[model samples]
Target: MSGPLVSIIIPFYNDGYVNQAVASALAQTYPHIEVIVVDDGSTANQHLLDPYRSRIHYIGKANGGTASALNYGIRMATGEYIAWLSSDDIFYPHKVAGQLGHMLSRGALISSTDFDLIGAHGELLKPQLAVKFASAADFLRALHTFCPINGCTVMMHRSVIGRIGWFDESLRYTQDYDYWLRVILSGIDFHFVNSPLTAYRWHDKSGTSRYLDQVNAEFGIVHGRYVHGLNGLIARIGG
Candidate 1:
């Protein structure tokens, strides 16, 4: 059977590591895949994407932020499913194939896999984070404590945007977590694949490290909305 087309959207800003990021998307074992790279006003790194000009669909936009860039790319994408890949992270070759299979087998609209935390030079960090949720209460409990889904490790049906809309443009950080919260609250059930399908890069210069304060501040704002609305939400999340 033919698989649905999965658009791997990479919102490119920092030019330094985009090559590796794009390369991984192109290497996906899944055949029905399209790679879309959105250049978010990175003048210095624009040239780095020149080599892949003939391969991936590229979009050039002003420096709004990661959220805006991803929204733009999604708007321009023509695929049944959408997957976000960070410009600094690496998606394993089986990432798309594995997640896509999981979503299909489970009849799920969204799926996310476990990923490894790696250093700037690609050295593995200790203790890979794994996801397991037997019930909605379990998932909500995990979310109430910390984000269980990694943005790059997540794949959702494009139809979800019609329900939850785009990322919150106002947020400069933690938008992924915010988006996931919206997905969960919108009565959407997500499947978690235990396979490690991506590597999340952590470094001193990364956005999470450089803007740690802003990330924390935005995270507080994102989850706080749901915390107040958690009274009867567990049932909707279960299915």
Candidate 2:
């Protein structure tokens, strides 16, 4: 049977490693895939994308933020499923195939897999670097403190967008975290895949490393908005 088309959306800024990211998305072992790279008004390193212009769908927009870029790319996606990949990160060859298969088998609308941490030079800093929660309740409970789902490691069906809506453009740093909270509150449980299928790059230039204070501030804001709702969810889950 033919598999569904998965749109791998890459939200790019001025990151120099965008070429590698695009390559990885294009290299997915899953044959039915489309690579969409949304360039968020990148001033430099955009020339690197020229080589694959013919092979991938490319979008250029004003520099709003990652959330805006993601929303734009997702809106343009024609695939049944949406997957986000950062410009500096990479998807393993089987990332889509494995995760998509897991979602299909489990009848999941949204899912995320474990990921490895890679250094700036692409050295493996840690393997399968995800907190293994014993149950969905454990995962939801932990959300009150911090976000466990990596946006790049997540894949969701198009229906999820209809249900939970798009990422909050107002959130500069914690859009992914805010989105996950919304997903949970919408009564959709995230299906976890144990395989480390994506490489999360940790470097000085990464947003988390450079804007720690701002990110933390935004995290606090997002947490405040959803804490009550999520707490009730945890209570209902017997946490």
Assess the local accuracy of residue 91 in candidate 1 as a C-alpha lDDT between 0 and 100. Answer: 94
RMSD in Å for model 1? 2.1
Model 2 pairs in collision: none
Give the Å shift of residue 213 in candidate 1.
1.3
Model 1 regions lying over 4 Å from their true place: 131-135, 235-239
The lDDT for every candidate, in the order shown, is 0.86, 0.94
Error at 69, model 1, angstroms = 0.7
What TM-score quantifies how close candidate 2 is to the native fold? 0.98
User: Model 1 residue 163 lDDT?
Assistant: 93
Q: Give the range of the ten consecutive residues with the poorest summed lDDT in model 2.
A: 136-145
The TM-score that candidate 1 achieves is 0.93
**Per-residue lDDT for 122-200 in model 1, tens only?**
8999446666677768878777767878889889999899999999999898788888888877778877888889999
Task: Write candidate 2's Cα lDDT for 1-239 as tens digits.
Answer: 59899999999998999999999999988999999999999999999999999999999999999999999999999999999999999999999999999999989999999999999999999999988998878888889888899989999999999999999999999999999999989888788999999999999999999999999999999999988998898888798
